[model samples]
Structures are given as structure tokens and as C-alpha cells.
Target chain A: MRENLLDVENLTIKYKVKNGNLFFNRYREFKAIDQVSFNIGPSETLGLVGESGCGKSSLARAIVKLVGLDSGKVTWLGKDWTSSHASTDRKFRENLQLVFQDPLASLNPRMTVSEIISEPLENYRKDLSVLEKIELVKKSMETVGLSTSMINRYPHEFSGGQCQRIGIARAIILKPKLIICDEPVSALDVSIQAQVINLLKDLQKRFSIALLFISHDLSVVKHISDRVMVLYLGRIMEIANVNDLFSNPSHPYSQALLSAIPIPDPIREKERKRDNLVGDAPSPIFPPSGCVFRTRCKKSTNICSIKEPREKIVKLGHRVACHHVSDEESK
Target chain B: MNRLLEIKDLSVVFDTPDGSVKAVNNISLDVDRGECLAIVGESGSGKSQTFLTAMGLLADNGRSAGIINLNGSDLLNMQRNDLNKLRGNRIAMIFQDPMTALTPHMKVGEQIREVLDHHQGLGKKAACEIIREMFNKVNIPEPDRRMEMYPHELSGGLRQRVMIAMALICKPDVIIADEPTTALDVTVQAQIMDLLNEIKTEIGAAIILITHDLGVVAGIADRVAVMYAGSIVESGEVFDIFYNTKHPYTLGLLNCSLSLEKKIDFLEAIDGHPPNPNNLPNGCPFNPRCKNVRDICREEKPEIKIKKQNHSSACHFELGVK
Candidate 1:
């Protein structure tokens, strides 16, 4: 079996929000991410799929230490790094990188492409000379399909796809073992998205880098992920291999989400058996007791509201969290 | 042809400091009553600008020249007062972001009532009754309670429903929904699309859907117009666009999209980025990225030629998605 590059256990995150009524000094805790646990192996991709405001971003941030973790244990290469500080955990910081959702906003407009790409080098590669840094930047730009001569140009001069290439270049310049691509290609066109996704796959093959690809799109996630995790209201609904998850989704939420995706073929779209969620997700602040998705589940029962269901193995490796899900769900 | 809305040779050019950028080139299409025609393209493809110009909404520096004949009336050359009288009555627009389109300070019911008030001159009680009925028709639960709430108090899905209710309040002959579901989640997008399809059948009004997603087009649109660099590269029935796509750009688009219905190890991506509008290539705007581009493609542009009974393409070579 491949070695685990990263492991997370019982990760829980909460934010403090003031009650709307000002008559009393009272604050409530909003659980952004509940006790979630998952792992990624070397050179493997763990796809995180969820709707907006579902705590996918929060969990990613917590892993890289961008946000403060309320309680959790994140182990990096068999070492605990969750409570570690930035100055002391330089190796961990250098090894994990982030590619943001908005290409234009994530990149600095005033900074040149070379400078934006080389910033990580400056932070982590003080040992390399100016010539070595320039050589490395040129090679990295070429790896992402950008011309070496365009390094001196600014971000505003490039298109959305080119800007995202710059972002990927910056993330990979350090040769980080793990790259957290948060909706990396969602901002680009379909053709451009294909280009970027292919680039990421090629780079991963060359560098053997594990990817934490987060996106709301089921189709894009299924394209590049080794395993997929479904999140709802700060909790995991299901986690399975990409093929198993897409073909035989066990959780009711997963079934509904997969069905809601608009297939490209007209005949397939018309003939597909669609399972739509009844309504929008309830507020994260007041998430329902027991199962977070019980309010929207089609097979919801009295037991769903009274008791929280733990993760159960539905297949050889697939696990799902739902009271209504049975072994028959995998069939 | 019994077309409700017909646009001929529609072009939009923005006078910029650098140069005049052609946002929408000489493009033409039509919509019939009780049918949905979707214009699908990338961000800079000018699909939205084509319909925006029809609604008499263009930036100060932009100029448009086209024959937008709606029910035999030239909407492009119509006087401002006359067009204003028809707008929100015979033709309405739904923007991408419902929050910005809706007034935050006003109640949802009053905002919808204003449409009926201005167009039909209905009394307050009469307007409220019709507005509440519209809310119910759009599947908004607790119509009375929702009518009193502000835009922020409602969810993203609900707010879009209110916008649709307002747009259909006057029962326009044509409704231009520009990327209406782009901002919503997938589940919510399905809900909104289902609601829209239901309403279209009930009202028998033509729908012009502008979006960048081909998946959405496959689900709801009867006909598809694939736009590239401000011009329509392909126009055909939805079946033709999905199953028998002809244009190189359309083929590239169909090949690149990831599918949940099937698994693909790799994607056949188009090589280069879309050309800049101000400095587009001389021949085919997509020649820079087309794999089968020839020397002649660099010298001259091709016009939209008929491919089938109801299908047309604007490509020099015979390109098809395999």
C-alpha cells in the first residue's frame, strides 16, 4: 500500500456569531466543520465536493494552518503539525501550497508573472542563487505551458487561463508534496479548464505531488480525483473511490447531488433518473440534530432525527453516513 | 416563420481608448413563441451583449446596429418612450445576480407590484393579489410572508424566484434570462430550471437563455447557438449541437467538458486561449486555436453556411466531434 502523506482526525471548527437581538450579551457558536476525518496518499487526489457555505474551504484552510483550528489533529508525514507555529513549522509550510478560486483576485495585479511565481522561492529557497532561481522559474513556467519570455509581463496582461497557470507555477515552484487546489479551474472556460486539469495531472505525475482538489462541480472532481468526499453542513456525507462514488453513490445527498448535475448529452440528460433535493440546505448555524442532511433526505425517518448515524461500510472500501443507507445502496 | 423575436446582423462595438473592441460581431438568430433558445459561449464570446443590446441596455461608449424585430416592431430603432412602454410588458430581462437586480430596501411584493403598477396601472389591492398569485405560480412557499420580506431575508433560490415572478408579472412575449442559474448551487439550479421550463409552457413566451454552460443548454434549451469571439460559430437544434456538432470551436467545447455519465482518462483540450477582441485574428477568430487550421483560414473569414435542414456552421473545414 502507498504511504499516507497526510491524515486528519476528528477535525472540528466553529465561529462565534452574535445573536441578532441586542437586548442581551449573548453569542452562539456556528459549526463550520464538524468531526471530519480523511487521508491522502502519495501522488493521490482527495476530491472535496460540496455546495456553497458547506465548510469545504474551512477544512482546507485548517489543514494548511491558514485559519486557526479549534480542535483537531492533522498529521503531516507521520508528524503532528496542527498546533505547530509558522516559524517552527517552516518545512510544513513550504511543502503545502494553495491555488485559490479566483485567478485574477488571487494574483497580484502589480506584480509581474516572474515575481509572483518566484515569491515562494524567495521565502523557501535562500540557498539558490539568482541565476538558479531564474532558471527554475523559466522551467516551471514552461511546465505549465507558458512562454518563458512572458515572465516579465504583469497579471492583468494575461487571460484567466494564463493567470491560473501562473498560480499553479507559484504553487509548484517549491516542489511541494501537497498542493491544495481550491476550485482551480472553476473560473475558466470549459476548454481552458481541460487545459489546466491536464496540466495539473502532468505535473502531479512528474513530481508525485498529492492534490487536495476542492470544487463544487461533480464532473470536474470525478475527472481527476482518486477518491471523492462529499460534504454537507460541515460534515462528510460519503467518501469512496471516484468510480464507486459516481456510479453507486450511497448517501441520499450524494445521489441527489450527482443527479442534479446537468449531463452534456441531450438524450442522456432527458433519460437520466433525476433525484432532486427538496429545498436548499438549512442554515449552518442551526443545522439539524442527528444527520445534517436529514432535512433534505427523501428517505428520512423518525430515527434520522433522533439519532446521529455513524459512518458504515457499504462496499469493499466505500463508507457513508446516513441512517437510511443500507448495503443495498451499493448495488 | 412565425417568429416572435428576430435579430438580424446584430453587432456591438465598444469605443475604447486603445481601439474599438467588437463585442458582438454580425450575428443573427431568432426565437419562436413557446420555445427556448440558448446562447452558449465562454466569457468573452459576447452572447450576453447580443441580448443586452436588444433590451436597449448598452454602455455609454458602446454602439449597436441591428434589426431587432419583435412582433414586427423594430425594437432597436423604437423611440425611448415607446420602448419603455413595451419593456417589462412585452419583453423583460433577468440578470445573473438577483440581489443586485432586486431592491434591498423594498419588500419583495412591492417590487413585483411596481411592475404591474407601471404597466397595467392596477390598484394597490389588485396588484398585491396578482403579485401573490405570481409568487404562488413560481412555487414560492408562504407567499404572504415572503412578500413582506426583503431580498436579504430570503435564500438565493427564493430571490431568483421573486425575480422570475416579477419578470412574468406582465406576461412578456420574450424573456431574456442572462446566466440566471450561474450563481446558484447545482441542486438549486435544477430547481430553477424546472420552474422556468414549467412557466414557459404555461405562458407560451419565448425564452432567450444566455449562459456559458453547455450542460445547462442541453437540459433546457430547444435550440443552441454557440458563440465564439463575438460571432455565432454554430446554430442548430439542441440535438445537432450535442450529437452532431459541426464547428471546430463547438467540437472543442463538446470534447473538453468532463462528464458524470461517463469517465474519461484525459480531455481533448483546445490548444490556445480565446483571442483578444480588439486584436482578433484576421480570418477565423478561432484559427489560432484550431488544430485543423489551413493557410486559407488565415486569409479569409467564412460565413455561416447551411449544414442541415435546421443546422448551420461557420467553419471552413468539416469539423465534427468524435
Candidate 2:
């Protein structure tokens, strides 16, 4: 068995919102992410899937300490780093990097490719000389398929795909053990997305870096992930191996997500029943009681709306949070 | 079948400081009544540009020399006033971002009423009643309550629904939705597509869905046109295009789409970025990226070659995917 490189337990996040009229104004807690827990092993890729406004970004920010967590334990390499300050968690920060959604916005326009890539190296290592830094930057650029000579050009000179390469270079310059990629390839064209995904896989295999790949796209996530986690209203819905999850999704939410994905072939589409999730996703501010997905679940019952379902071991290693599935299995 | 829109040799170019950037070059396609024709390509493939130019809606710096015949009228050379009369009345367009296209200050009901007021000469009371009915048709729940809400008050999906209702208020013969579902979530996208299909059939109007998503194209398009470098490189009946893809670029696009049905060792992506419009190559635009690129491909540009009764391709080497 592989060592558990990261551990998260009972992670709950909330924001304060004002409620009621002027005279009866009261502060109410808005739960963006409910009690969610998952772990990533060494060099493994954990794919987080959900629709928009589902707290995936919040979870990502919480891990990087960019935002404060309400209640949870986020341990990296057997060390509790959730409550740790940036200065105290310098080593952990170096080992855990984040690549954002938009590479154009993430990178500074004034900064050249070399400078953007070398910023991390300079921050982590102060003793490196100019010549050494240049060499490191050149090698890192080459790793992401950019020419060393092109490093002098500014970010605006490159295309969307090339800019993303620069972002990947910056994230990996420190050789982080874990990289939190939040929709890194979603901004690029399909062909360019393939190039970036392949580059990521090659880098991960060579460096054995664990990846927390978050995206709303199931196809792209299924391509590179070792295990996949489904999230809804800031809670974990299902976690299973990539192949198993795609083939036999246990959660109703997972099934709805899988069915909604438009397949390229019309023949296969005709054979498959349209798995439609009724109603828009419930507001995260006032999520429904019991199961968050019950509001949209086709198989919802009286018990589903009344009682919150806990994650139950469904398969050999897979776990799902749904009372419908558990009840069917028991019967 | 009535040809609602027929575009012939549609070439559009934008004048820039560097040079003329060819946005849409000699592309010919037609949309029939009650048919949903999807123009699919990556960004800058000129699918949207071609249709936009056909509608006589080019930017200030852009010019077009082509035949944009709409319902037996030459829309391209029509006077601005004449085109304006036809634009929102006989033909309507829904952009990708409804928030930007819609006014934030106006109520959702008033937006629909404004469209009617501009073209149909409807009074406030009549337009409001029509707006509420259109809202119900678009499947917007609590139609009356939502009528008073601003654009900001509605969700992205609902805002798009409002845009659709407003666009279809006049029951235009053609509806051009440019990436309508691009910003929306998958579930919402599905809902939108279903709604669009239902409305197109109900109104008997041709729908032109401009998008880069091949998956969406596969789902909704009766016919698919694959564009590259400001040209329609391949187009055919949906089944032929999906099962017997005839162009290198089209095949590459099919291979690039990630599938969950079978495990793939690697995604087959077309290498290299698309050629910049300003620095276009001499021959076929896809020659640089085409795997089967021959010596002839680099020397002469190939015209569209009709392979089947309904399928055509613009590649030097014919796709052997029988």
C-alpha cells in the first residue's frame, strides 16, 4: 500500500451572511462546503467533479491557505498545515503548488516567460546565482515544450496554450510533491487541452507528483485521474477508481453527471436513456436538509428529505453518500 | 425544403494595421427551414464570423464580398435601414453572454417587450402579455414573478432563457445562437439544447448554432460544418460526418473528443496551433498540421471535393474512413 501523503478530515467551510429586515437583521452561517473528507496518496491524481458554484474552488483555496477554513484538519505529509501560517508552512507550500483556471490572468503581463517561471525558484531558494537561475528556468521551459530563446518574450507574445505551459512551469519549478490544478486546461482549445493533459501526465510520471485536478469536465478528468471524487454543494457525493466510476457510478448525482455529458457519437447516444436531473442545483447558501442532492434526485423519497445520508462503503474501495443505494443493497 | 438562408462564397476580411486578416474565406453553406445546422470549429475558425457577416453585422473595420441571401433577398448589399428592419424582426441572434447582451437596469419582461416594440409596433400592454406568453413557452417557471426581475436577479441559465424568449418573440424565420451554452454548466446546456430543438421544430425556423463544442454539434445538428482557417473544410449530413468523417481536420476533431466508453492510451490531438490569419500559409491552412500532408497540399489549395451525395471535404487526400 502507498503512503498517505495528504489527509483531510471533516472539512467544513462557511461564510457569514446578513439576514432579515433592517430592524431584525441577524447573521446566518452559509455552508459552502459541508463535512467533506478525502485523501491523496503519493503521485496519485484525485479528480474532483461537480457543476459550477459547488465549492470546489473553495476547497482548493482552503488547501493552499489562500482562504481560511471553518473546521477541518488538512494534513500534508503527516503534518497538520491547515492552521499553519505561510511563513511557518514554507516547506509545505513549496511542496504544494496551485495552478489556476485562467493562465492569462494568473501570469503577469509585464513578466517575461523566464521571470514568471523563475519566481517560484527565487522564492524557495535565495542562494541560487543568476547563471544558475537562468539554467533552471531554461530547463523548466524546455520541460513544458517552450524554447529557451523564447523565454525573453513577454506573456502577451504567447498563445493560450503556451501561456498555460508557463503556468505549469512556474508550478513545477519548486518540484512540488502535490499540484492543485483548478481547471487548468478548460480555457484552451480541445487540441491544446490534449497537449497540456499529456504534458501533465508525463511530468507526473517522471516526478511522481500527486495532483489534485479539479474540473467540471468528466471526460478530461477521467483521462488523467487515478481516482475520482464527485462533489455537490460542498460535500462529497462519491469517490471511486476512475474506470469503475465511469462504468458503474453508484451515486445518483454521479449518474446524472455522467448522463448529461454529450457523447460524440449519435448512435451510442440513441441507445442510452436520457438521464436528466430535474431542477437547477439548490443554492449553496440554503442547501436542503438531509441529502443535498435530494432536491434534484429522481429517486428521492420521504426518508431522503428527512435524514442526512452518510458515506457508506459500496464497492471494494468505493464509497457513496446516498440512502437509496444503501437501502437497495440491504434489501 | 425552403432555404431560409443561403450563403455563397462568403468571404469576410478585417482591415488591421499589419495587413488584412482573412476572417472568413469563400465559405458556402445553407440552412433549410425547420433544420438545425451547426457550425463547429475551434476559436477563430470563422464559423461565427461567416454567419455574422452574412447577417450584415461585421465590425467597423471589417468588409465582406459575398452572397448572403435570406428568404430570396440579398441581405449582404441591403441598405443599413432595410437590414435593420429585417434584423430583429425576421432574423434574431442570441449571443453567448446574456448578461452583456441584456441591459441590467431593465426588467426581463421589458427586454422582450423592447424587441416587440422595435419591430412589431406593439403597445406596452400587448407586448407585456406577449412577453409573458413567450416566457411560458421558453419554460421559465413563475413567469409572472420573473417578469419583474432584473438580469442580475436571475441565474445564468434563466438569463439565457430570457434572451431566447426575447429573440423568439417575433418568431424570426432564422435564429442564430452564438455559443449560447458555452458559459453554462452541462446540465443547463442540456436543458438549453432541448429547449432550442423544441422551439425550432415548433416555429419551423432554421437554427444556426455556432460553437466549438463537437459534442454539442453531435447532439443537436442535423448537418455539421467543420471550419478551419476561415473556411468550411468539411460539411455533410450529421450521420455521415460522425460515422464517415471525410476531412483530416474533422477526423482530428473527432479523435480529440475525450470519451468515457472506452479507455484510450492517449488523446489524438492535432499538433500545432491554428495558423494566424495575418500569416496564412500558401496552400491548405491545415497542411502544417495534417498527418497525411502531401507535396501537392503545400503547392495548391484544394477546392471542396464532393465525396458522397451529401458529404464534401476540402482536403488534398480524401479520407479513407469507409
Candidate 3:
């Protein structure tokens, strides 16, 4: 069997909101991640594409066990990490690492670059000497295209892109198999963004690391991701190869998104008709009962409102969650 | 075509302790009446700075040189008070972040009314009536109830609509939108663009769209100016800039743009950072990152060569690309 780097099945994360008269009433549960399942193979890049509050970050945190999962199984190399095994799972921490969205917020301002990179190494490998930790920190910094002499500098001294490189160096110090990079380049300037993207691609090649690159930018995802999963309101709308997803987007939401891209050419732009989704995205506190996309979906019908559309394989590997597309194409 | 706003050799400089930073170098462009001119560039490429400087909206430390003519009247030559009077009344600017732009302490109705009170001869009652109509034009639901709410009470999309409402309340002749929808998500961004397009057509005002996203500029802009390091490296009809791009920087930018088209495994990134404004390179600002860099591009700065009737490019290899 080909070794799957990581497998997250039916993962759900719900935060408890404490309100109503101090300690009197029961706390309400806010479901951030609503039953999502996906996997990353060895040396493969699986993109998790979603908007601001679609629970992409929450799913990343659940995989790292930084946040508690309401229910689901996260398996790494056939080892189950759920309930009893989650806390005791030592391999999970060593194999999985996460880089947060904001570089400035993720990094500790007080700590120097050397200390930030070496922190993980110190925690994971207690047997290693202090000199060895220093060597490893220097090596990882070089891997992310940072200089060793600059290691003594604080996080505040570096630019946004430089700070992200430092963050990547810190994550890779442990040599984790899977890295969940959550909007790593979103906060960066456009020109600096390209630099960081190229660096990530290079590191991914050198380390043979599986990346769960989460982003709202479709362009960035299309460039880095092997396969793309489009999410809307904590539900997967379409899952296909990057080429197929971009070229032949079957789902209406994906089509709308793809059409929304402003072509630099005015004539071509005028020719292309974009069906802008109506109204603001509904609150996730109490999402639509049927298909989550029905509220804004142009093709949503009675069947969609009554029952959630089943995930069907449209192409060899492409999966879509749409009744209209599935039914029309199937015939 | 009659020109609505013509900017000639515009240069905006901010005097700092470090030195004079040329935010917007000697650049010139014209926006015809009812035409949408998109100034496309990345952050610090001087897209917003050009319009801000021309409008006399820059802070005290900032200073601008050259002519900014609105129907032959030198806007730059006008008095500071006159400039302020002409600002919201004639040439209105809408910023990127609407949440921060709107007053959190004041009611939405009162805020929009203040624009009318200063620009137009209208009292609070008359202004309130006009404000509700503007809100309806922007397609804000519950316009009556919304006027009572503060900035914090509305959603991001709603806040942006309110900003649009305020900018269009006086029915300005020119609308300068600086990345109006950049902060919002993709879906909401599309809606905002549609709304802006609708407003432009209904109001029949010239628009200056300043943004980094090429996709957003595609449908709206009539002409496009590709800026790099505070200068217009390429300017032409939007169709020519996108399809028949002359400049290598413009081509690289289009290639880098994420679109509906399935890109190859690797993206074509323009190699280096945009040249620093304060410490700009001697020759071409895009020389370091440009792939088609020649000996001439490295040694001497290239002048803007008029390729077609309206198309212009400042590159050694302008005609080399198809």
C-alpha cells in the first residue's frame, strides 16, 4: 500500500460560547468545522480553499491537535488519533506542523530568530546538545533562504515576507511530513508574495513534504496545489485537479468565482458574463438546512433544499457536491 | 473624445528625514468624460498616490508638481480652501477600507448628510431625504433602519455601500476609487464591482479605478495604465494591454495573474522586488526583474514610445513581444 502521509476523516470543531447570566444557562456550541474529510498523500499538496469564516483554519488547528475536535479521526500512517490515542500520540506532533496566516502575530517578538527556529528542535529532541540545536537552526534558516548571521536579529526587524520565511524555518526544523500552511502569503505585498511562493515550492521539492496550503486566493492555490477543494460555508462544493478545476469548473459557485477574475483586457472582460452571487454569505451559526449553497445558488431546487447532495465522482478524480451539475451531466 | 480630467507630468514627493521619496514620478494620463481609467500596479507602485496627489488630498508633508487640469482649470494652482471645496463636490475619492473610513461614533444618515451640508445648500431634513435615496441607489436593504445605525453595526459589504453612498451623495463629476473592494472577499468583491459599474453608468461620471487585481479591472476600465516604481511604464486601451501587451513588465503581470485559465505547474513571477521609491534605480525601474532586459535598458532610461494612436510603452523591447 502506498503510504498516505495523513488522513483526516469526519473532522469537526465546535467552539463553546459562554453567555446568558454568568453560570446559570448552558453554553451554546458554535460549529466552526462541520464534518469535513480529506487526506494528503506522501509528497502531495492538497489545497484547502475557502473564504474568511469557512473554517479552513479551524480544520488545520484540529489536525495539529491545537484545538479539540468535536468528533472525527485523524490517522497518520495507519495510526488512529482520536479520543484515547489523541493525547498519547507522540508521532502526530513530530509528523505534523502548522504555519499560521499572519507572520507577525505567529512569531514571538521577544525571541530572536535563532530561538524561534530552535524552539521546536528543543522540544522534540531533548537529547540533542545546545550546539547541535544551533547548527540545526542555522541549516533550516538557509533552507528557507535566510542568512545565518541574521539569526541574532529580532522578529520586528524583518519585513513581512522575511518573518514568514522565519516561520517556515521554525516549522521545518522538526522535519515534519505534513505542513499546514494557512494563508502564508496573504499578508505579504504582491511582489514579496511571489518570492515566498517560489521559496515554498522549492522547500516542498527538497523536503518531499506534503502541504495543506489553505488560502482564499485562487491564483496562489492554482499555482501550488496539485488538487483543489473549493469550500463555501464549511462545506466542500467541488474537489478536482488544479487543471480541471480551473479549466472546467462544474459547480456554479466555482464558475462564479472563476468568472469574477478581472481580465486585464477590457473588451475580453466585457464579453465574459459573471453571475455575481446574490446577497451576503449567510451566517454559519445556523446554516441552510439543505444544501449549504442553496441560499446563494442560482440553480438550487426543491431537492437541494430537502436533502444534501451526495458527493459524486464526475471525472476520474474530480468530485462535486451539486445536484444540478450531477444530474444534468449524468444524463 | 472630450477629456474630463487631464494630468500632465504629475510628480508627488513626500519629504521625510531620510530624503525626498518620489511616490509618483513624472506621469501623465487622461480620463475622458464617462470613461473608466484603471491604474494597475502592486502596492507602493504609486497607483493611489497619483490620484491622491492630483486631488490635493495628500498630507501636509507631501507636495506635488505639474498640472492637474479638470476642464482647463489648474486644480493644482487653486487655493487650499478652493481645493477643499472642489474635493467632495466635484472630484470624490472612495478608499479601500470602508470600515475605517466611515465614522464609528456618528449615525450613517448624519455622516452622509454632512457631505451635502458642506457641498450642497441642504439642511439636515432635506439631506436626510437625499441620503435615503442614495442608500437605495447603492442597494442597501432596510435603508430607513440602516441610517440610524453606526459604522460598527453594519457588515463589511454594507459599510462599503455606505461609503459609496457618501461619495455619490453630492453627485460628483469624477469618482476616484482606490482599491474599493480589495479588502473584501471574492464573491463580495464581484458584487461591489457590479454596484460601482451601475453607479458609473447611471451617474455618467468619469472614474479612476486604482487597484492591484487585474481581474477586477478587466470589465470596468476603458483604458489601462501599468505602473512600476511610481511611473507609468505602459499605457493603452485595456484590450491592447491585456491581449496585445507591448511591455515585458505588463506581460509578466498578466502571466502572474490567477485566472480561469489553467496555468502551468509553475507561475511566472517577475523575479525581484519593485525598486524603492527613495532609492530608485538609474535606468528602468523594472530592469532587475525584467527578463527581456537589454544593454540599453541597463545603461539609459527608455523614453515613452507611442506605439499606436493611444498605446504607449517605456521599454527597449516594446515591439519585440507579439
Best by DockQ: 1
Per-residue lDDT of model 2, residues A24-114, tens digit only: 9888899888888999999999999999999999999988777788898999898888877777877788899989899899999998888
Q: In model 2, where do residues sit more than 4 Å from their true spots?
A: A18-27
Error of 2 at B318 (Å): 1.5
CA lDDT scores, all candidates in order: 0.91, 0.89, 0.85
DockQ of 2: 0.70
| Candidate 3 residue-pair clash tally | 2
Q: Which candidate comes out best when scored by lDDT? A: 1
Report the alpha-carbon TM-score of model 3 versus the true structure: 0.91
Ranking by TM-score: 1, 2, 3
lDDT of 1 by residue, A201-309 (tens): 9999999999999999999999999999999999999999998998888898999998899988888887766677777889999999888888888888898898988
Candidate with top TM-score is 1
Give per-residue CA lDDT, model 1, range B133-181, as digits (tens).
Answer: 8888988989999999999999999999999999999999999999999
The local lDDT score (0 to 100) that residue A214 gets in candidate 3 is 97
DockQ, cand. 3? 0.52
lDDT of 3 by residue, B1-322 (tens): 6788999999899999998899988999898878899998887889888888778878889889998998767898899888878888888989999888887899988888888988887998888889888888898988889999999988788899999888888888889999999888888888899998997788889889998878788878888999998889999988888888899888888777666454565667777667678888878888888887777777888878898889999987745652
Q: Pick the winner on lDDT between candidates 2 and 3.
A: 2
In model 3, the Cα lDDT at residue A8 comes to 80
Q: TM-score per candidate, in order?
A: 0.98, 0.97, 0.91
